[model samples]
Target: MAEEKLLEIKDLHVTVDGTEVLKGVSLSVGEGEIHALFGPNGSGKTTLLNTVIGFARYHVTQGSIWFKGQDITNATIDERARLGVGISFQRPPTIRGVTLRSLISFSSPSLTDEEIERTAERLDAREFLDREINAGLSGGEMKRTEMLQIILQSPDFVCLDEPESGVDLENMALIGKAARIALGRDSFDGAGCRSIKSRRADYKAGLVITHTGQIMDHIFVDKGHVLMNGEIVCSGNAAELLGEIRSHGYTECFRCAGCAGRRA
Candidate 1:
């Protein structure tokens, strides 16, 4: 039997405000696969992720978004979330009056306070649990906290935006580890040691965005996509594409308008 397609965006056109941000883009990540989306600033990477997960303000002017075989072009954000889609934001909001402790408890109703403490401790977040979410948190702290939420939620399809954006080396490893754990790649070693999640990880799929591409060092990527000027200029081997970008920058392989160099 063939594995089901976990998330699919076909010829999607998206606009923020009156201006179109994504001209026409298509991509897919199958069950248990992780796809890396790479692009320069203003290339529509965040717009695409925000669209796929159905952030209402990002109106889809044309095309379709299908997740787990259902077209969800017009689905509500909560609808998409209930269908096993989860995202760790690059800049998570600072919700007033909601402590991280309360947030975690809400995410996993069955978890005991003791287990929550252990989870927070593992992420070195014990101190911030009582703090308002994202309130006074450093960039790295915000990333880790959101990752912990995603782990607890155990969404089937995950979207990671700039998982390594502002973190130092230590937090980068922690964030990477959390991402791997969310995607089910860090579940167990050959020696049978467990990863963070106590339950054996269910099959998970992911769409990850990277500016520095550091997250790729931790999470194995099955596919790579380049989006420029609101469209996907190319899709190919993740490692090869990243190496190409590193060697010559994004222009060396972009096919979009106003970009020069060979096709990526």
Candidate 2:
């Protein structure tokens, strides 16, 4: 039997500001599988994620994006959000007038104050809760803020961009824990030991874009793909592909992916 696909993109072409950024890209993430996307800077990795959730400026010129058997090629961002699609941006914006506390209510209206405070503490965001959303936050803090939203809302499909970037070792563990919570997985063992299973077993389906693949150290990566020149050029074992890219660089990915035509 084949795995159930939760998110599917077929020959997806996207144009941003009149420039074609994603050219005929296609991929599928299985239900409960965490897939990692890798690429060099400006390779359309972010474009792919933004387009999936209907980022306004990115016009889908061709193909279709389907979530859980529904075509969302023309769905509005809010429409997609209502369908349980959540994304944590690499750089989130600051909403000067809106406090994170209020924004949490917007994301999960029924969440109690106790639940909010506990997640805040788990993400080291107790102080940030009262601050304006993303206002004066460090990169790590911004990432944590986004994670907090995703956790409270419990989105079915999570899109993460570089959750490990700018995060210290201590904080990386916390971010990983938050990711687990968002995915509805066990974060701790019975004896109070953090689960060695953070990167394994039950998980929600989603795609993650990783520059350093450091997030893979914390979350389970079932498969990995390399995107080059706006197309997915390679796919393989998550950890193994990450290791290959680390040792030989992305040129190795192009060579191995049989994408020599795009290398120049």
Using TM-score as the measure, which candidate wins? 2
Runs of candidate 2 with Cα error greater than 4 angstroms are 188-202, 257-264
RMSD (CA, angstroms), candidate 1: 3.8
| Candidate 2 vs. true structure, TM-score | 0.90
Give the local distance difference test score of model 2.
0.83
lDDT of 1 by residue, 1-264 (tens): 765678888888988998899997977788778899999999999999998888878999899999989998999988888888999999899999999989889867888889778777777788888999999989998888888888877789999999998799978888887888788777423222144435433547899999888999988898888888888887888787777778767876554332344243
Candidate 2 residue-wise lDDT, 192-223, digit = tens? 21353344334677789998887777677888
Stretches > 4 Å off in candidate 1: 1-3, 188-202, 255-264
Root-mean-square deviation per candidate: 3.8, 3.5
lDDT on C-alpha atoms for all candidate structures: 0.83, 0.83
Window of ten residues with lowest summed lDDT in model 2: 188-197
